[model samples]
Target: MKRIIITCCLLLGVTLISFAQKRVLVEAESFKDIGGWVIDQQSFDVLYSSYLMAHGMGKPVEDARTTVDFSEGGKYHVWVRTKDWAPFPTGPGEFQLSINEKPLEDSFGVSGSADWDWYYGGQVDMKKGENTLVAEDLTGFNGRFDAIYFSTEEGDVPTNDNEALLAFRKEMLNLTENAKDVGQFDLVVVGGGMAGTCAAISGARMGLKVALIQNRPVLGGNNSSEIRVHLMGRVDQNHNAKLGRIVRELDNGDPGNGNPDADRYGDERKLQIVRAEPNISLHLNTHVYEVEMDGNTIKAVIGRDIATNQEYRFEGVYFSDCTGDGTLGYLAGAEYRMGRESRAETGESLAPEEPDDFTLGTSNLWASLEREEPSDFPETPWAIQFSEEYHIDDHKADWQWETGFGNFNTIYEAEEIRDHNLRAIFGNWSYLKNEMPEKYSHHELAWVAYIGGKRESRRLMGDHVLTQMDIQDGVMYPDGSVTATWTIDLHFPDAENSKYFEGEEFFAGTKHIKVQPYTIPYRCLYSRNIDNLYMAGRDISTTHVAFGSTRVMRTCGMMGEAVGYAAYVARKNNASPREVYTLHLNEFMDIIESPLSIHNLPTLPQD
Candidate 1:
């Protein structure tokens, strides 16, 4: 056993120091068996790609294990990157570390720093051979596990700086910075959400070479299994009928917001639709972080594989910032807005009286399932305290469980906001389980979204910024292409809930100022400055008030279809997005009205 273990250790590149300390670095995402645990890439900038978060809803996920060969056999101190999520006395985010099927003396994941940092998990004897490391979740609560460092010396820990960590990761994993070239395409869509997915399909169906890059494994962004937001807003209504056939084809038929099943998002169906399109090159688990620019036009986009950390450069004639955060436009140095405008700035009533950094909050939807038997929940003293006086009575916490309004930038402070949401969910559930045990005896938390369903952020400026006046007055521009059907539904922190959890308002309230379905001008679909750049999704040109009505998934999907159609027109005319709006306006309108474009809806294969 010792001879085989030593040989295996040497063969696997396990570095060893004779008469010195040894270390074994195991990436959590590299676990051989991750069963129900999901990889979190939203914080790729901060946490890197090694982190894995457990979202068991209420049931604990199956243990995740990985085999590692020890360079030298001895007592090793283990450290894991985690946070003191729900920093109450007894944190709900609890997990146990196991080595070679034996539990570690120190129970880890119970206490960690506020940010991503290494927490000590006491020393253990490791045999000089192949051994298994397991991340055992004690509670289904959102316990995040990054990478585990089995070190001979405590001083050999990694720093929290992503750049430094990246250097360390490369050295540890033996990765190179040299990026591979992905073939050029006519159009490249940076996000795989409803907007990006629809944009890719819309362009592919038009016989254009389209490359769809998604940071996660799934196609639907917020609508994916990771986020679980229901498709809202009515499609195929009024002038927008032709624009939403793609969204309808991708719809999974679950109208409810917080369906427990991750499969409810129809991940496979969305993938199949994108796969069926020959012109569309689907790059899943690829995150586009940088853009190459030539004067004003984007030359290419650089991305990194989330799993392998391999870099890739995708070249394209045109690019779409369907990344609801306006990631591409921002990378291309295009003008954009992040928060609410001053009433004086837009001359709109809904605008804040003063210019402020207030934007609509993101949601963390969660639901409980009725179990056959009663379930016991652990005490989470580290979580936010909730009593019957401030408790919400419900089996599901839907879109209303929102946070990160006004206080933080959704793009920059994404991980923080997501952590806050997890704390809120775990904290609230702990309260319900402890205080109202009789009322919630049979209910078990089925699922809670870790990927936030963000409503507004980084609206890329376009030729024409749609305002409240445009929707209320029903002002139809000559370039009117997509019509938004949802009313002006603006979200605010619920006043009653705010009184208790100020600055951490998890409950949201919406004020719906109804308006007739109005047409959004085609000029709102592309960047105002970038020549070949196009945009869709919530990041389109719209005032904060106007976005209230247009930010729905279905509405954004239609906008994607419009952009896709425009991409085809631009390619055919050998014109830029700006030229398509300026010169080919009539041609664009004609294409939208054509039977080939409107009637041809991509459907799932009849099984």
Candidate 2:
């Protein structure tokens, strides 16, 4: 007990402690049983860690409990890491910390600093052998906490500095300084979106060993049940017809945006298809944050398990940045661009007059179902207040219900974006139910996305950045691969929404600039600087104007398929991503032109 407690903590051996004073740092995410609390890693990039969230959707959730054993136990100071998400005078996210079923002195997660920090919970007496710690949610309005720390000394507290906090967490949790080695693969495809999934499948089908890593539990990114966004863009357009074979196979019929039915998204079908591929190693709920660079090439990528906080190192011959935010490329020091491009920069008609941070926003969609009986919704003053005239009077929130525009850094301020969307959803619903009762008497909120469907972020620069002129003017590159057919759809705050909440608008409006089908150049698929990196999806090399057309899921999926086939050429020739185009373009294009076994789509009976 002394050896384990006095020194570094052993997870199985139980208590973590300091030498001078007995201390234990219990990560809330590492709790033994998180009954109703959902593990949230949405803000891990900014916050440095995942936390337990009471996402009971306005109902009190079940308790999250863990057992702790220590050599010496007495009066110990308790510190909880949390924030007041709704920082109004009265907060809705209120929770209690109970030890061995006895409630702690303080009601945590309410009346605290808006930023992530430690909140003091007055000292508690403990037994010498084993004790239980529980977090009981009171309000169910998204109460959250990072970790709970117990110390014999009163003043010794964990640092609020996120960077320093990372080091401290590693020490306390006994996390390895070096990432634990995951098995080697021919290609490591980070981000299990439509693009990355297709990449893995296409690569595996071509007899290449692959690893597909996704941050969420499901394979589909935005199209998954968690986010409920439909797959857009026309697959099997002009150019190589073989490119979209895998994407068409994966489409299980779009349920439309914000569909409440989980089965409609075909989560298990995507999982089964990926699992059926013997050559793929599917890693879900694993977020790749650290990049191991071997000079110009990426040697391996380091990821952490959101639930268990276990670190793993995945080594690969080639890597793909399918992460919509371009997280992988950014980590490898790949040159990337964000925000709208000015007219002078891209020479595009639709380009913004001046370069600013007004990039396409993220959407956190919500939906409601009508019930037979009338339901009661509590007043949410913390949420955005809406009136009859200003309120969006839809039964379900569609793609237009969006945010994260105008100076909002979609990557850094992701959590705020989602929260803002939530406030908008709850507030509008509240107004309708209370103010206009007759219209929405039977309507009840069914689902609201916790995971935001992001449209634009870091655009990893490649050999050539696809511009609006290339698509509209039909400038054909010799290395043209995947065909783009979706309209150049650019989004902005709805004029009516802006009139109500000017700088912080939630509703979105878009204008579609039509363009003829054009093949996207292969040059825009891989990183320009990083030797082994290939990219697909929203993060692919494209100016803001060009990305407006290329950001759709079906198109991105075809891009992934193209990258996969190219990887086969790279592996056979022992070439880099750049060389695949410069040297092996002929061979790659020949393969792309070949016919593929198409899946049978049941057609309607001819009348």
Candidate 3:
């Protein structure tokens, strides 16, 4: 009986192998008609060849959708082909084939045209019974698909020709190796905002080696003159802390010393102060691409300079992500949360009834004016989605024009949104200054920001997430405190889509709570999972409602000082941030109070 069963098993295995040898082939007759042959809309496109023909008139297109059905428990070969001869040439294009939306291992791209049929082939799995097949174009471009043919015969397994997989692996390996070579630093500050700048300066003033990495060309992230957003925070109204003092010293001369335009100096002065720090090495236009880890501790960080195409690897004992976007903390495997939390979770009356993914939107703001000149402005050709005909002009703001309506509001994809907003802004200005010479005849385009001002992104998960209740109750911690003074300001999600104000809605929830400055706990500063990583600015752990109050730049700067000094103390005593918060609380407070002690400036107000 055992012998008979073994023989039956061997025969069944051979029968399955025979069915696996089948192949299906698809071919495109011409590049022009390749559009209908694609299977996946998200991954494929026929615009690459069209773009080459259009003299670079269009952006790369990767749109294609085609589906196939098959029985389960089988294997089949799949391939795509182009006709022997065509008017337009074919280039590189990738196809990602999947079975029942569960991606199969076999997929490849066909490049290099031929006078004869050009074919690229791979294999796919067919589950038991009926199964759906799809081939998606990963790159939007022009390509051809000929036909699909299958065979049911036993044969050896075919080799894969997927270059994309190999290329991706190689890139990851290169990044890993590069990250391992970064040099060491006593302190590394990941963000270049007001807090980050102050942190670096404070650390350097204490004689600690510091490296300040800011993603933007300018130093001030949100309050930079580039964005032109005003600074806000808890300061002695009568004698404002020389928070802007370091900046003044770097502006060739102290502009605040008597210059009437000191406040207008804004970020330029801040940039100078950071750049002038003797112990700080500034890396502007550099992005922290990845973080290297050694068990629980961060080993080093790998960064790329966008302008110079240069890479940096810095090993630091303490790292602070002031990027405001929290890039470093995210890259370092820090725990984080996005969107709004439920009232059940945070125990705040203002918390959302349920969890939500809605976040504050970023803005591409322009400072425009009612012009007195009759000069004509250039006309815009793009589509205009807002108009007074829709009653959007009722609240139409010229100087504060924003573009957060139909796109993602976070800074992760800020450049794309900024472009879209600028086009509309310039287009509207042209109509006002040139087309409507009566009402806007006196109005002129004054200034447009270089980049969109981002509101939120990845918030690092800290030891304790700051809930709206914490802010309402004025919770204080013994570790450290960063005070915030902004009201709970929430913007409507579909403001741009609304006909009432052309879709812009600013809702001050319930009523504005005018509360005295409240302190943010130190636990809200560092990642819960990451041992050596800390974050400041708007990206720190806070409920959506609480963030409405804490996201201001002035408040973020104070957070920077707290974390920066904690980092300095950690380095001096070989301690982690938690240790400094717990054991060396006094020393930490001293540093914050005398951040400019090196410059002989007055101490900060004690807690």
Candidate 4:
């Protein structure tokens, strides 16, 4: 009997493998006519794949259409991989699946399943040739799904278990197990925000072959058209005057955050500058989730194309973790810290008494425009309920329209943070339009940012963790380069906003601690343990209070410029990031002091 059972199991495995072609998987992001759906890849590091989100403010968007050609299709079971973003009872993101213009009876994204899981849409008899699939959005409030599955056999469905799901997706989509090599580079910068963009351009100008990778299609992170954050801090005050040149060139001179004019942020200017550099290879819409470590150093980093599901391997001598969450450093086993530090430990006056999980929150800003006539907005019962006394009486959502403070982590719970902001935005708008129509009757909703502008998450540890004392006293290290000019602006929950909503406050308040411009050391730009790794932007080594000043975009850009010059010095002497400071400080400083020239970089440092 045992022998017979083993034979049956072996035959079953072979049968399953042989009939794998009977099922087909269609990724939602790959749909030819996306229409009104937006590709959201922010949480791809955790979710493992990019999904489509309906980002309509309060109205249902146009249907997303795609065609599938099956080999003589008969009856196929339809399964949709989706999630209920907000489930007070029922979710707001209710959508449907339609085959050949006929809608399915089952509704998806409203199943009250918070996590990403599969939903059965019943069996349908498909035609032998091409069948058009339409994703119909019932609500305009962030309805999202990863993929759709069609199978010929019964009782055979995809698994929701992350590990098993990956294998299933690979088999169904024929995704490659081995990553294709993308050639060797002197530096691989894994972000294309202000910091990473400057790092790539500076390195290329200094004669280093560079690879700049960005998860989004655009170049800027917070300042992109998607997020609409204006450039801050004085780029001119840097100790190295040349360090700010690249930042100035990219600044679009937008006066405020969440501006309705997307062109005011200069997305094209950033992309054009990066493309002009012959030595830099910019890979947009690529998310890096894995890294190969050779002892303490990174051997190679593997990235996946968000829409296409193609994988590539990048090998480099040195790497930078500008991925604000310290994603690359965390994967490479580098030391990092999240949340606030204790006053006793760091000896900073601004720190909390005890080390707690209270970190700065994220912002999903929105804007509105004044119209001649009143515009209708749907009353959202699924959204967070707002009262006249509790709601913010404002025309536009700003940086203060933030969430995910206290226990909420900006990295792990990023999706929740963004969703919470969405609820607040819609609820406030509804109350203003429905309850008090006289004030905002002429105003219509403009652009609402789906990408959350994160303030703090994981701060990578370095040899020197710049504290409040360092910025306050102006402690000057020998390798001090970028001059941070922004005020020490630490953000927390607003007093009134928190009074109504305790743990999840959408509004923010900050107490600015004014300080003189301070020079930041190069030691804070590289990892302490990871020999070949460098860092910039918000992930750079800084205590919670000190980061308030250095976390601004212009300051982060200067840090990137310093890192680029340091990389050039390191390459000449065959040294790590630390050696560039300890062994070749003078040469690096000389390069920093010189004016930045796009075509004419100063001669090589003496051998």
> Considering only N, C-alpha and C atoms within 3 Å, which residue pairs clash in candidate 4?
none
Cα lDDT of model 2 overall? 0.86
RMSD of 2: 5.8
Supply the TM-score for candidate 3.
Answer: 0.64
Residue pairs of candidate 2 with colliding backbone atoms: none
Highest TM-score against the true fold, candidate: 2
Enumerate clash totals for all models, in the order shown: 7, 0, 56, 0
How accurate locally, in lDDT, is each candidate? 0.80, 0.86, 0.54, 0.84
| Superposition TM-score, candidate 4 onto the true structure | 0.94
Tell me each candidate's TM-score.
Answer: 0.90, 0.95, 0.64, 0.94
Tens-place lDDT per residue, model 1, 129-198, is 7787888887777688778877778677778886667656665654544467888998999999999999
Candidate 4 wrongly placed segments (more than 4 Å): 1-21, 602-607
Tens digits of per-residue lDDT for model 3, 1-607? 0000000011111012223434332222112223434211101111111011110101223333334333335665543333211112333334554556766454444443432232434455666544444445543322334333333333422223223422321221122233223456788998787778877876777667789987666777656655556566554421224333333332332222112232563556676667677778888766666666887678877665432224577788888888776767766777777777888887878777898766766655554455455554544344243344532231133223444432454544453454445445544555555545666666554545435566766688888788777777776766546666777765544433443434433211224556556677878887778888878788888877888788876677767766766777777778788777778878876655555467653322222
User: Candidate 2 on 247-359: residue-level lDDT in tens?
Assistant: 98889897999998988998999999999988899899988888878887999888888877777789999999999999999889899999988999889888879998878
lDDT of the structure predicted as candidate 4? 0.84
lDDT of 4 by residue, 22-60 (tens): 777788877778889999988776566788999988788
Candidate 1: list runs displaced more than 4 Å.
1-24, 69-78, 101-103, 121-131, 150-154, 261-264, 595-607
